[model samples]
Target chain A: MFLKILYHLFVFLALFGSLMVVVSKKAIYSALFLILTMLTIASLFVLMNAQLAAALQVIVYAGAIMVLFLFVIMLLNLGKQAPLSRRSRPVRWLGLLFGVGIGAQIIAVIYSGFIPPAETTAAASVTIDHVARLILTDYLYPFEMISVLLLVAVIGAVVLARRHLVQGVETVTETAEKAGK
Target chain B: MEYMIPGNLVVAVMIFAIGAIGIMWRRDAITIFMCIELMFNAANLGFITLAQSLGKPEGVAVFLFVITIAAAEAAVGLALFIKIFDDRENIEAEKLDLLKR
Candidate 1:
């Protein structure tokens, strides 16, 4: 009973944060809201007995990704922009209507398809060793592929971020370094 | 105990919907990127919840890969934004029209 209450509270917080991210005027605010949402989602993971995932949620999503987001928002100086341009009022209302419709549909799905199953001892099943074994054994090939993908992404980012040297222009970081010297 | 509460999945779906709408509603490119990240987390939450309920550990493994991939995507995406901003002064998504001709 206590766990169920905690779960609902976390879910509410997560959803509220997500809404704030969508509507917030500033990019930094949106990023902060995202962090809040991520943190609450991590709590949800804990409630669901996914300790590893909960840890990763906080470490990866809230820690690493959010830092990158804030770094870019600062680097580009996108903090104070003009207020958002609004779509037509009717269009906005229509979108909201569709959103409510979809939401109702999802509720119906929950009632129909996701009936609660018989309670079991699932909490004792997913030990750390079990997940570790699966990764190193069954999912090893894909794990290796993800590493390769990361390597490629790093190279791609470096190449993309560099200014066109053929144009005889220094990139922002290069110019700043030269100025410091 | 009701093991399959469906609450987590509902939360996941709501978050995902927010991301989908945010991508269209927000003008800033970085904000849109953040929304995409939100969508990724929504999917991750779903995976973790389903794994726990089904007593499967593979979902946790998949969650790790998903996070790593999200990190990679963020790196490449932010770099692209930086490049675009260097070429053009702003990172607003709607204003980029260099290829419109």
Candidate 2:
């Protein structure tokens, strides 16, 4: 009974936080609310017995990703004029209409009784050991691929950001040489 | 025995829809990025729930991959946004017409 109540609480918090992320005028507020939403979802993962995922969600999504977002927001220093400047009233209304349509369709599908309830007997206890074994054995190739992907992403980000700096430095040196001559 | 879908998945779908709508309704690049992250989180929740219900660890394992990819995407995406802002002085999606040429 307590678990069920907790589930409902987290679900409500997640939904509310996500709505705030969407509607908040300030990008900073949206980032903060996104963190809240992520944390609440992490809690839901715990409730579902996905302890590892819950921990990673907190560490990665709520912790690292949010910090990155905050850093970018500060670096950009987007003034008050930056939020929702491009979206007109009609675009917003149209988006809302489509959003509602899609939401209703999903809810209807859920209520249609097509999906099967979870079998209590099939709820295998997911210990960290079990997950580790599966990762090392059955998912070894994909696991290695993920590391490679991360490496590539790091290189790409650095190269992309640094290109402009390199050009700026070249321009400065060219002007300095011309002045010296 | 009548079977019903788990409520967790329903909530996940709702969050996904909200994120998608936010993407379309907002113009700030950072806000749109945040909405996209929200959608990723919703999908992660769905994966974990399905894993728990179906008695499989593969779902959780796949989630780790998803998280890793999301982190990479966030880094690259933010860097791109920073570059865009530097070049254009604004990160509004509609005003980003440089690619039209």
Clash-forming residue pairs, model 2: none
TM-score of chain A for candidate 1?
0.79
How big is the positional error of residue B41 in model 2, measured in Å on the Cα after superposition?
Answer: 0.5
lDDT (CA) per prediction: 0.82, 0.83
DockQ of 2: 0.57
How many pairs of residues collide in each model? 0, 0
Residue-level lDDT of model 2, residues A1-181, one tens digit each, is 7777777888899999999999888888888899999999998887777789999999998999899999989898975745664557888888888888887898788678765667774455566787899999999999999999999999998876664555435433345557769
Worst 10 residues of 1 chain B by lDDT: B1-10
Interface RMSD of 2: 3.7
**lDDT tens digits, residue span A1-181, model 1:** 8877777788889999999998999888999999999999999877766788889889888998899988988898886882454556676556656666776787678668664553475453466788899999999999999999999999999989876756877655566558769
Q: Which of the CAPRI classes, incorrect, acceptable, medium or high, describes model 1?
A: medium
Decoy 1 TM-score against native = 0.87
* Regions more than 4 Å wrong, model 1: A88-106, A114-119, A122-124, A164-181, B1-4
Could you say which candidate leads in TM-score? 2
